[model samples]
Target: MSLFKNVLYFQAGFGFLANTILLFFYTFIMLGHRPKPTDLISCQLTFIHIMMFLTGGDICLTDIFETLNLENDFKCKTIFYISRVMRGLSICTTCLLGVVQAVTISPSTSLLAKFKHRLKVYMTYAFFCIWSFNLFYSSNQIFYVGGFTNVSETNQMKVTKSCSLFPKNYIIKGLILTVSVSRDVFLVGVMLTTSMYMVIILFRHQRQCKHLHSTSHLRASPEKRATQTILLLVVCFVAIYWVDFIISSSSVLLWMYDPVVLTVQKFVMYAYPTITPLIQISSDNRIIIMLENMHSKCHKILLNMFLPFL
Candidate 1:
């Protein structure tokens, strides 16, 4: 195996493991009793966790390119179709999450704030729409994707199934790229605008507090904390995703079939979802306290166990 393939496999494995742990943690631990059922932010995080799992699966599928048998053309097509759909949905859902967060943090005077209360109510419907859009848009891949047998003789492989886009269907490929790029651009704009608004608001609030005769607690306010967390999340999201998008876009434009490009793109694409759990844990005070409590209890238990042996 090539160095690129080895790196891709490692990334796929890590992403899959991280997402799986996060899914379980959210479903069984973090999601119970603390956050209200009607909390839009909580629902949004749950949806993101699902997207992470799907993305991890897509990465894992790409990692196994060398091991997959190409005997059945139908199976190859199915794998390609599913992988494309999942990857598309992952990107779409991630964009939706950013948009939703932006709206959630908008100032009360802002137009987006009017819809804040409706986030939980509309979130499920929005998720459905995102999934449907990706599903339909990616259906073209089902018809165009082919195994190694259909690819050029120079790139043919043994004991490996390759999924390649048909050169004749350049129009469909263009459409896919357009939609994906447009969606990402819109989301990035929203996040940038909202983050800027948040910074301005925080600064103004600090100034007002300083001018007041009576001292007021501003540092520990929940609103301020949430804003800070959101800002951090936005920064991380932009840093990881912008680079990945650039790489993917460049690869498409150059029509490069290099395994190294694909490998880098795959890792960068999935890294965001894998690392999201740590971001959430760090930002959430309740989770942090719970973790500290658990650690103390474990320490006590270990001491007790060693006391008997001593």
Candidate 2:
């Protein structure tokens, strides 16, 4: 295989591995523990990551098969649909996560604090509604998408995944497109608001902490670390998503049938889910404690072996 193809496999495989580890850590490692609301949401998010990578693998295979001429771009509707559904789930789960965390660190007197009583219950409902809606929204794929025939410059027959909407009603197509775009916009708006709210909360908490102590004495609490992590997650998600959105939109608008755009789209889409576990693990004290214990054991063993005379 070529270097670029190897790199593609490596990135996708690593992402798949990271997401798998997250699932294992949650399901097996935390099985004995009572699951927190955030933990449950995170488990759902991990599943989204797994699905995202699964589709990513599909994309990789499709790309390889196309390069080998075993398949063509017109044969990609399944992967495309899976990608769309998973992306939708990922975004909604992220927004839900932000809202959960925002409520988590809210001041006792704040409006969000009032929801604390039934927050988890509400979150569960929202998560279900989200995936349900997305599944329905993307179901149009099965109706409007199919293999499209195209001939190469060399007069070779090729078929790839494409919209077979020409025979369908234009009004229906427009309506579906509008609905899809509007739903995405609404989700993004909510994601934006939740992120900003979290930011404001962080700022206020920081000011209060500073008022109570010197800046040098300010230490990041677990809540603070978690808030920061969520902020990073939101920022990364929004940025990557918007960039992907713009690229995808531009491709459709300009009819840019370029391989480079597709490569970039896949990279951005996959990179976030791939690194999610590492980001969460960085803020998790349990992982840190585990690493520290491992380090101490290795040091002790090496010391015993090298300093036996002592």
Candidate 3:
């Protein structure tokens, strides 16, 4: 395999592992282990990221499915549609995560505080809406994308070795582009706005804590740590997302897909999903504490076993 394939495989493997761990952690919490309000959203986000890797692997690692003898059109459309829907869900979930966190950390008297009690209900409704919208919105990919059969054809833009986007009317193509752009811009805008709100909240909170206690005595709250983690995720997602977006949009508009450009775009596209779970696992206090306890248990067991020999 080439270096690009090697890298993609490594990324997919690592991301899959990280996301699985996160999914299980959230599952454990949901199963009555001190669950929090944001656990549901976080769990959903992890699931979406996991699906992204799976769908992505399906597209890039075609060798895994050679025995199925699936038609190219079916393979392309199914994979592409699912991938697009998952991508849409990823952003929408992340955006909702940020907004929910902001609401979660708001002052008791603040306007956002009212939704805190009904947060779970709202999250459920929001999730349903998000899934429905994305499933419908990404239907366009099913119509436009297909397997590349004619190597001589210049009208279609090849996305992968086998999958290409069939040409559509310019007006229809432009409309699709506009809708996609608008959706991304709206979601990104909400994420940024909420992030700013969170930053202010954290700042004011720090000041209050400092006033109440000395700098050395003050420790970060769980809420503050969660907010910081979400903020970091938002920043990382926005940066990587725009790069991927620019490349994809440019490719669509220019009616071209250079190999090098596609490789770089793939890297950018995978970066966020790969990094997100690792960040969450590392930053979560509960995960850290659980890991510490597990380590302690292992050490104790090893010491007891060795003591008899010693």
TM-score head-to-head 1 vs 3, winner: 3
Model 3, 304: alpha-carbon shift in Å? Answer: 8.0
Give the poorly placed runs of model 3, Cα more than 4 Å off: 58-64, 214-220, 296-310
Candidate 3 local lDDT, 224-301, one digit each (tens): 889999999999999999999989888888888988788777778889988998889988978888778889999999
Please give, for residues 1-310, the per-residue lDDT of candidate 1 as tens digits: 3776777667656656655655555564544655432234444444554444443434444446436664545556666666566665555554555566657656788888888887767777877887787678777766655655644554432223345544434776678778777877887787787678778777877777777655365443655676676677677778988898788667656655566566677678667666666666676676677668879999999999899889
CA lDDT of every candidate: 0.62, 0.72, 0.86
Clashes of 2: 6
Off by over 4 Å in 2: 1-4, 57-78, 151-170, 211-220, 290-310
Model 1 error, position 288 (Å): 1.7
**How close is every model to the real structure, measured as TM-score?**
0.74, 0.78, 0.91
Candidate 2: the clashing residue pairs are: 73-160, 73-161, 74-160, 74-161, 75-160, 75-161
Mark the 10 consecutive residues where model 3 has the least summed lDDT.
Answer: 57-66
Candidates arranged by TM-score, highest first = 3, 2, 1
In candidate 1, stretches whose alpha carbon ends up further than 4 angstroms from where it belongs are 1-6, 29-31, 34-75, 102-110, 153-161, 211-220, 296-310
**What shift in Å separates residue 69 of candidate 2 from its native position after superposition?**
19
